[model samples]
Target: ALLDIPCYKILMGCDGKNLQETKDLYNLTDAEQELLESKRRGHALFIIGSKRLHVNFEIPAYKFSYMGKAGGR
Candidate 1:
């Protein structure tokens, strides 16, 4: 099943590769990196923030395991 959120939010993360460049440019807080690393290997991390809460969604490893799997991706 797919997870549904109620409202809109801003998501942030390191764009992988050139970690140093991303850090220098974005200046992400410790909390952000901490949150990203919380996910297991082979997981897609979504860092969502809004008026009420901040959250991370670690997508399942297999695309078929979730609903609306991306563009046969």
Candidate 2:
């Protein structure tokens, strides 16, 4: 059997040797670029889910944050 799943359920992966490459590849916004460039070695993971979106960071200590917008039909 096949289960129907929304595109948001799928996770996309990205990697780079440095923040600049990753920023360029993803075309990050000014704020995002500034955040990534804050540390000497920075990495970030972005995940989108049906109800929310998460941003995981890897720098000095492991950290993560999430945001969701309210909408309805």
Candidate 3:
């Protein structure tokens, strides 16, 4: 989807060769890949063309109320 999709995307744990596997996506410098790795669990990468933008996600300060009845037919 990386090659075909034209909208903004958020990726996590998709550094190094994973970016290369996208084919059209260019190589990230060692420093860039390491930055992605360092932020692993807390951040995501937004790949727009050959540019990889780092974005820190903020979860809303509210919780989901119980939806209840999981798997109810």
- Say which candidate scores most in TM-score: 3
- Residue 54's lDDT in candidate 1: 47
The model with the greater TM-score, 1 or 3, is 3
Q: List, residue by residue over 1-73, the lDDT tens digit for candidate 1.
A: 1223534433444345544453443355666555444543433334344232344455666854675557555
Q: State the TM-score for model 1.
A: 0.31
Residue-wise C-alpha lDDT for candidate 2, range 5-63, written one tens digit per residue: 33433222433466556566456566556555554233333424434233554444323
* Local distance difference test scores for all models: 0.45, 0.43, 0.60
Best by lDDT: 3
Worst 10 residues of 2 by lDDT: 64-73
lDDT of 2 at 1: 12
Q: Per-residue lDDT for 1-73 in model 3, tens only?
A: 5455776656666645665564335455666566666656558767776577878777553522343456433
Arranged by lDDT with the best first, the candidates are 3, 1, 2
- Model 1 sits at a Cα RMSD from the real structure of 8.6
Which ranges in model 3 have alpha carbons more than 4 Å from their true place? 1-4, 14-25, 64-73
Per-model TM-score versus the true fold: 0.31, 0.33, 0.49
